[model samples]
Target: MLAADLEYFQDVQNAYAALTNLHCIITDKQGNPITQLNNDPNVFHLVYDQETFKEVLNQWTRDFSKINSAIVYDALPGVKVIICPISIQGEIEFFIFAGCLLESTSKNTVQTYFEKILQNPEKANAIFTLIQEYSPDEIQAKLRKINKMAEVLIEHLATQNMKAHLVEQEENLGELLHLIADGNIKVTAVLERFLHENTKLDFVGYARKKGHDQFVIDECILPEVSSTLKGTVFSMGEGTLGQAAATRIVRFWDHMDMDPRNLFFQQKGIYPKSLFCFPIILEKEVIGIFFGGSSQFVRLENDISRVGKLTSSLIKVIEGNRFWQKQSKNNLMKMTALNEIFQVMTDVEDVKRILLIMLDLSINLIRGPFVAVIAKQSSRNSYEMVSRGLTADQIENYSSDISNRYFHNKQNKRFYHQQPVEHITSWSSKVLEIPIAYRTECFGFLSIGLSEQMLKEDELSFLMSLTIAGGVSMHLLEATTKVKMGQTVIDLLIEHQEYIDPDHFKQATKARELIKGFSGFSTYGKINTIAVKYSCYFIKYDEQFLTNKIKNDLIIDIVREYKLVADSKLEFSQASLNVQVLSLVWTYINEDENIDFLLKINGMNLPLLNEFLAYLSHTTVVESEIMVTNKPTANEPKISKHLKLSKREIEVMELVLKGNNNREIAERLYISEHTVKNHMTNIFQKLAVNDRSQAIAKIYQMGLEPEDVS
Candidate 1:
């Protein structure tokens, strides 16, 4: 909201003036009268019309806006002005001079204010009597009333703003369509007006990204700015502005005058107390950075949020520009790329070769930057993946077995998924997934990261056709190739057990095992998978590498000593491959004990096994959950809830039972030690105990159970 927005309502101004006997006028920041809202301006005319007395009038209003409150300003001896500052978005732009009257204390000597400025003192006796003596309390009451009226005014403006914004959005869509059709990328021109109309900042800058790290200022919106800001180049990650671009998150910095990180503004002789940086994002990539700041501290509403919405809408309107058919450039290539995928699929019998080519074709057809083939864990207990345009780090992030969790119970057709930021370093915003399935059995997933949204009807049809053909071909080809893969330990169980699919991992209720320090568990009919990675073959790094018969015994002892019933394992002995990957899925016939958490707790528990995990590298202990029946099993401990505790506190108590110190538990949970201590403190208060030992005793007495968490 701006001072100009306040001027739209004239009756509100008159009503305020009528409530108190005072001339109501809008004045410049320095207090010079600009527009009169009420008829009580004869006093104003006498002051402004008088050449010598106008200086005194200016002195009355000078710095009134800076006061930040309603005040009875003493303009001259025996005279005062009732003024209230109208602040919009924390910037004082103008003042409302509601009253010009004689002061109560100077009733008899009112002629003092007019001694130098009054040209005809005897003739203006009636004008002096027209001015009435006003109490400060009355003016204060009137000011409070104006505030109440503003509350109502704000509600009215909200409804009107929504209607206006809709119209503006429609118009902006039109502007964006023309730009897209013309192939022009001057997006700043479309965004500039909204900033000017809705905000009042001391300095506003727009920097366009020229390279990966380089950004050059294309424009700066401010009046009479003397310092050089435009054409200034800033690297990504240089300051708060760079951080916003790097993280794609909006950030605000305050007290920048005292911070050396404000060099961008400091160099321009503009030290802002509060500053905001917004990364202008398109297809999850920051093309520019928008900067806004005030030399003084100010409050912010959804000004940035509204602009963010508009910017998103801009991307959509251009990317999905309904007039796309008018340009034959994109439509011309749709069929050619569609034809190439079918030609490659019919002749390819190798599954991975076909998958790799399909991924490449997806990138070529859609102009997307990334594509991946995410396969479900095979019998060897490992997921085989092939990707294009994705880094090794990115590929690792996607191997989170999202499909295993996402498709547990429900079956989905071709779908679009926006990749969430797993951490600060990775940005994978949108992906289109086409499940590679043979009938109901989903063998793998085909995904394409969308650099442009809204696939054309024909383009989507072509992708669907390719995936359907590829799935059928891959499923038939895997029949013969699957014979030589590594086997699952489920076959080695003492009792013959039923076969289970690798993807069906339970997610809820089974987390009950966390209480007893088991990493993750399942009930009667459910199963859980625990994945582990190794650097190389056992022969290459281990002095204890054994023959085929001894190797099985060594691995079984190493695993059983840690209380795990290994359900599946994969070991690659080829000299050509540098790394050997292993995924462990723990399973049992009658639900025998498999304590997964012990491996992490025992820092030096298994020297040979720890060597297998790697002597130095960080071993991540991530847990995946599965849902079992709420009914407790025969061997499961039945504990009752007797005291109030938080979910985290109960989990902390579980780790305490495992004999883990505070530091170990902190590392295990990926939380700070301070947070673990806080949970411990809460646990102490709930159990009425002061130490870990006493709390553990009380927990046992209370019969702590998984369901007891409340």
Candidate 2:
């Protein structure tokens, strides 16, 4: 157990983890997980990615070892854990990842993260409900518990390894275990130390089996032999070395002649009276052979057992290096691959494509051979499953269960779900479900067959990034499909505001469901109805590039301008692709004043828009019957934003409404009559009216409409 007596430390680990509600794991210096079966199953609510946690440990060694008590927020998914250096004596022997227990830093942190990133309140709330909320004092108390755990673990480790001194006792078996477990010791170093530390042996040679027929001296301590016997090859079953290779056991020739036993050695003018050879076996097969001889009578029986154990330890050290090295490379590659997948996921809008990326990412994240995504194609479609690494029969079985049970609850709202896999070939058979959702719309869930039930912080966070990406893609695709729904659907949704007939208006009904899926709405008289219209001469565009530029600018202007009022929890789309028209109804939550975003785009005193089309927008304050649910009523008066016309045009319109002529308005304003007439003309053109009477009526209707259009 990670080169320490952790068998005794298992209960301590589980107790601390259960008591503090922080994920705890101990890894050796090189970041390999120390197997502890007693880790509390209920302690972790999210993921416990072994590879990602190892990466964190490696990062600590490289960048944060000095700051051992650092609590890394967003360390794993939405988790914060402090990395404690589990030291023995003065050197760090292991690392303990302790928890402060959070999905985000605080409630405010979660809100801010979702607002700018996914901007999904349902997800934010789901997270809030799962995580154990900690106050300042409570958090401090949890942290103290972590520090105390670290202290106790280190104290126990030191006490356990303090029994014997390595320097005084040369052949202690525990010394070899600790030495090879350091992870930096090379195989050559272990073999060399085996002979160099023993003064009784005159020469040594480690011959690895090549081609299963001959053995070659891959490493040698026989300096007295001629021609550097490092690469010496000999036939098997001929001498002591051959006998060791033949028998797969320790072979000692204590009373043999120096001429025949060291025949290969005597070929190079070397002579030894006694010699011993042994097979280095791994998994019950001879991998190599080690031979050494003495110039005098050696006590072969006394040191044979120690040497056999030493050879086994040597093989493990070599293999351990190779294994960890390969693992490190694979982890780096997985991270790079995950980043690429996440980047591609963000740009993709198709449900199938996004789920495909999620499938690829999930398998790599958990090394799970099978992964599946179960979701509804749309509001009307039946549940479907997308998967990787499963047989057709398995898919059918899983999909039936998931669609009928997982999707059975039409009103299912959850953070996550874990279920035991039946007919398990191993106890490691466990399944985890992370929903792909945005706001409260769950398109489907990522059902992952995990190697273990525990999910890492980094894994959950990484999966969270995928989940959020998929959710956003689903929502954006739905919203975009609705807004550009060929004007037929949009017209139907706008004109027929009553209950929709499910059979006749399928698209409109689905669009309304999508609208309700975005969030709940209440029928109130304060919704901002933002409408954008084009000028009469706006058709002065011919070039494709020029039209594209104009369309892009107008689309940006429409969405950006609409965002002026609703501001938060709003996803807008272009109502008309050709004219850049858009309409979205939203009200501010927890606001005290009414949303009165007045966009007054008049040609008079209008700044020229570089070289492209000039955009003019006028807002109508239509009191909506649909207000966002759970929003505060406005106690303060309405705050009017940008107006339709300039100050001069507004003043001129006021005089016109007051039954004054242009000359009287000019006298009152101290401006020229031409200026007053020009202002009126600009107002008429912007409002798209011909006469003063129509202009006044349009302005009055647009500026202050008190009708309940619900």
Q: TM-scores, in order shown? A: 0.33, 0.24
Where model 1 places Cα greater than 4 Å from the true spot, the runs are: 1-9, 29-59, 62-65, 75-77, 87-92, 100-136, 142-173, 186-303, 309-332, 335-710
TM-score of 1: 0.33
Poorly placed runs, candidate 2 (over 4 Å): 1-183, 223-227, 319-710
Model 2, residue 507: distance off in Å is 95
In model 1, where is the ten-residue run with the lowest total lDDT?
A: 490-499
lDDT score, residue 461, model 2?
A: 43
CA lDDT scores, all candidates in order: 0.52, 0.53
Using lDDT as the measure, which candidate wins?
2
Estimate, for each residue in 383-474, the C-alpha lDDT of model 2 and write its tens digit.
Answer: 66788877787777777766665466554444332222232322244567777765445678877776655665446545654665566556
How many clashes would you count in candidate 2? 11
Writing each residue's lDDT as its tens digit, candidate 1 over 1-710 gives 44534553454566666767666776556656555547743666665555654465466556453666666666555666666665554566556665567645666567644644576676356456667765667656766765544443444445446646655654554444345435464445654654555454676666778877888887786554677578888888887777888888777776677887888778877777887876765434577787777777664333455554445334333332322334477754543443444445545766678778777767777776677876654433346789888888788877664554444435433222222222121463677676665444666777767765666655664565456546545654554332222222211111111111112212111221221122222121112222111110121122242222123443333333223212213222221111111211122111332222223232222222222222111112221113333544555333223465655666776677656799999998899999999999888887777776566545434434323332
